[model samples]
Target: MTTFTDLNLCPELITTLKDLGYKQPTPVQAQAIPLVLAGHDLIAEAQTGTGKTASFALPMIDRLSRTPVEGEYHEIRGLILTPTRELAAQVGEHTLEYGRLLGMRVISIFGGVRFDNQIRKMKRGADILVATPGRLLDMLVQKKLSLAHLEMLVFDEADRMLDLGFIGEIRQLLAYMPEQRQTLLFSATLNDSVEVLADKLLREPKRVAIAARNSASQQVKQSVYAVDNGDKADVLSFLIHGGNWRQTLVFTRTKKRADQLTAELLEEGISAVAIHGDRTQRERTAALAAFTAGEVRVLVATDVAARGLDIDALPQVVNYDLPNQPEAYVHRIGRTGRAGQQGRAISLVAPDERRFLQDISALIGKPLQLQPVPILENGKLIEGGKLPEKKRNQSGKTRKGGANTKAASKAAKRAPLQPEEPVAPDTPGKRPSLFGR
Candidate 1:
């Protein structure tokens, strides 16, 4: 049987991995590390929690540990571009943790934080730079950081990065990088766009794709619950507090809904907070830390900001609102059942979400059996109660953008905004967050 020992990683990386309690390499990591170590460009289609960070990080560290350091500037040897700031921080941590034994200096750059601090850090140079496209581009434009020395360029979560509209920024960063450098792109699914990006960036790259569609990790058992809009919160509260679920990540469709739900959950005496693009970077970081440290029991978030985020031991994930895009369903549920641990995913589907549910089922290539929403005898949610399928708002009339007639204006004043993708079907693959979330 193959082991980390058999992978023949550098001793420095091996020591750090052992200290981090990694007994063996995951399939993606085992196959990927060797290829990366050989300075080969790669496109690894692996799920979020497959330890891909270490897969690429170990190789970067092995190659950079003995690099010819010049004066004080560490000369960035590797650049890892991630979509969200949270993911940027995560990949940065993994690089530092694994590369520390070899004296590799790791830096994480992302927007929302002040630029002066990042500029100051940039003056000293980073050995391994993990960044979100926005800040990296900002720094690049400011002439504070140069990619001249970058040896490895990685677009971690390539599809998510592109969906989030980081493609142009990625191209900008690429423009500055040495063309001869090795490139690596990793995502759960590889669509045509990712293939095109890889083709343009890599040099006859070795491909290692993992067919874990509708799956990030097998530990997450997925189920759906049909409910009315009014019962969604009641059902959620029951599952979290009633079911004794200490930690559950609930995904909402909008930032407003996230804030509203978090507030409601707190009123019910359940610890919860909302994380979204509207939040200051500090608030998002604090909320995530609180959740990680068990200070907060629930993290309610919007899909736009939470994709590609890695939360450890995530036992349960609840979709308070179904995502408009079917592909987002996989990303949301992928949060739970990670790294060989059992996890549960419960999605709440309203009458308006029927098509969304069906589309998700088709995307994953499996039918999702939806049960009824669990409610208390008084039409409330009871502890350990699993409700059978029930339709809410028999007519899912959301005041969508109908022609602006006088009667329409009157209806709009009274109707709530309809839930649907802001983008047209023609531009489906455009920016995932159009409003610059």
Candidate 2:
């Protein structure tokens, strides 16, 4: 029965949370907020959707509110570093929402966006900064931002930052912050590297774990569908159509795969888009907005979207391509089943991906139920695992204007539908459907 008021959050913050419809503190917030409020450095290990952002944000806002800054100079008072631009923006937004009535100034900085505007925001001064390591480092080098006045440092999704090769950049950024600041390092897993980072960054930190280490939400019903590599697109299309999934977050192994899957889904008349490292900030923002607003039915993404892409009441997640690391599988499916809502995680497993599936199962400590692929009546071949032939024909020759590819794509979009035949129905070895549709 713990509430935000019981957590010693200020009246302003309590009112804000009430307005935001957050009646109770999540497990991470309940456990970590006190230690942060007590001014102790902390290392928190929790799942992605466990409200870890507020765990540090609430306390930081409270401390800043009580100690009111007197001067006009807006040197960064609190710094939160994330792995990806999407996560940085998300954390920044959450902090702003919670600190809205407190007169807190928050800014998010990351790469792939114009520096002119971010520089303008920085010049105006920010009470809290949520940023990706690379862009933050660039600002530090350019002397556009400083962390010497920082009272708190939070590294949200610290493990993912390491996975994205930001450890060196993180180390450099830490060197810029004051040595006496309260450091909060939150990671989904406490691996050797993360532990080392914690040791180097935090001092005698309090440890908090609100969920099982490196585990996805148990509320998510997970399933796997065995299909040929060539049939993955068709199978995916069938599942989306048959299940009538409205807002699905699909993960792929590579940026190319994300784009290809998006194209395929669009061809199937499913409004879809891809977000990845190569996309500009404007493109990424537009895609995420479209997906969040339900303008798009499917969002095909790489691991970049696995951690920070928060969609409210997202009912389904699909592993279009299995990640080589099992921890990633946990984060991918973690996007759904958030805030205690029921969700489904569907994985399309090809013959070559069996090892990945095994690794993921072992990491999650449970086997995913095998689900039969929905039958597509038309036998038309939908290329799945292979590279898209839009640019080059099957003969390995570049097509002029890609006319045939456009025609084929149009045909796929306009194709008529037949009643789906349930694959592997009533088989002796068949497992119960996890999706319950």
- lDDT of predicted model 1: 0.76
CA displacement after TM-score superposition, residue 37 of candidate 1 (Å): 1.1
Q: Write the per-residue lDDT of candidate 2 for residues 342-423, one digit (tens) a residue.
A: 9998887765677888888787788764434433235322222332335211211122323223323333344333222222
Q: Which stretches in model 1 have alpha-carbon errors above 4 Å?
A: 214-216, 374-437
In model 2, residue pairs whose N, Cα or C atoms come closer than 3 Å (at least 3 residues apart or on different chains), thus clashing, are: none
* Structural similarity to truth (TM-score) of each candidate: 0.87, 0.85
Please give the distance, in angstroms, between residue 318's alpha carbon in candidate 1 and its true position after superposition.
0.4
Candidate 1: C-alpha RMSD to true structure equals 7.6
Tell me the deviation in Å of residue 357 in model 1.
0.4
Ten residues in a row with the worst lDDT in model 2?
Answer: 391-400
Model 1 lDDT tens row, 176-227:
8888888888887887777778778889899887656544356777867765
